[model samples]
Target: MTSRIDLTDKAKELIQELTDKHGPLMFYQAGGCCEGTQPQCFEKGGFYPRMNDAMIGLVEGYEFWIDRDLFEYWQFSHFTLDVLDGFGPGGFSLETPLGKTFKIHYRLFSEDELKDLEPVTRY
Candidate 1:
């Protein structure tokens, strides 16, 4: 099945480093004005998802979620999680203390991929 999200090698490595320190983790992508569009990483359950949030998929076993409104805006595209070197403006994302930032790269899905999209879980 075509999953809603995937992760880059850099993101994977960073996730390992973070996991070593924080144990299981989760991601929440907020499209709000203050949070910008960066994905926030929290130790699993650190931040609660609202009813309007969607659990898109997992990144290396860690759940990845997005605001339902934002997911609706980008539902036709595929999301790839990536890591950046510098800290991002995301408030409380675990990576900020380590000089790292989590980001997403998007591309519209192919006709075939679109036909087999995985279902999203609502919070």
Candidate 2:
């Protein structure tokens, strides 16, 4: 089945490095205040998912989840897990000390692709 989210090569490599140090990891993107909008990398199960949050897909063998409210706004798009060079404010992600930040790059799915898009599961 097609995935709703994917990781860049650099993101994969960074995840590998992070996993080596932090063991398994998970990702979350929320729509709350503070660092909510930015994607965050955490040790597996470090962050709890709200009951209605959505599991978009997996990347690098890890789950990628998004807040329910945010998912509604982005449901029509596909997301790529990407990294940026600088640290974002209040970034509590694993990559913060490494001067990197996790981010999302998205594009709207085509009509055809949308019809066969992978399904999302709720937490």
Model 1 residue pairs with clashes: none
Reference-based lDDT, residue 71, model 1: 91
Over the stretch 33-100, how does candidate 2's per-residue lDDT look in tens digits? 99968999999989999999999999898999999999999999999999889997666899999999
What is the clash tally of candidate 1?
0
For each predicted model, how many residue pairs clash, with residues at least 3 apart or on different chains?
0, 0
For model 2, the superposed segments whose C-alpha errors exceed 4 Å read none
Each prediction's RMSD to truth: 0.9, 0.9
**What is candidate 1's CA lDDT for residue 46?**
96
lDDT of candidate 1 over 9-123, digit per residue (tens): 9999999999999999999998787788889999999989989789989999999989888999999989999998887875589999898899899999999999999999998
> What overall lDDT goes with each candidate model?
0.91, 0.91
**TM-score for each candidate, following the candidate numbering:** 0.96, 0.96
Global Cα lDDT for candidate 2: 0.91
Cα displacement (angstroms), candidate 2, residue 54, comes to 0.2
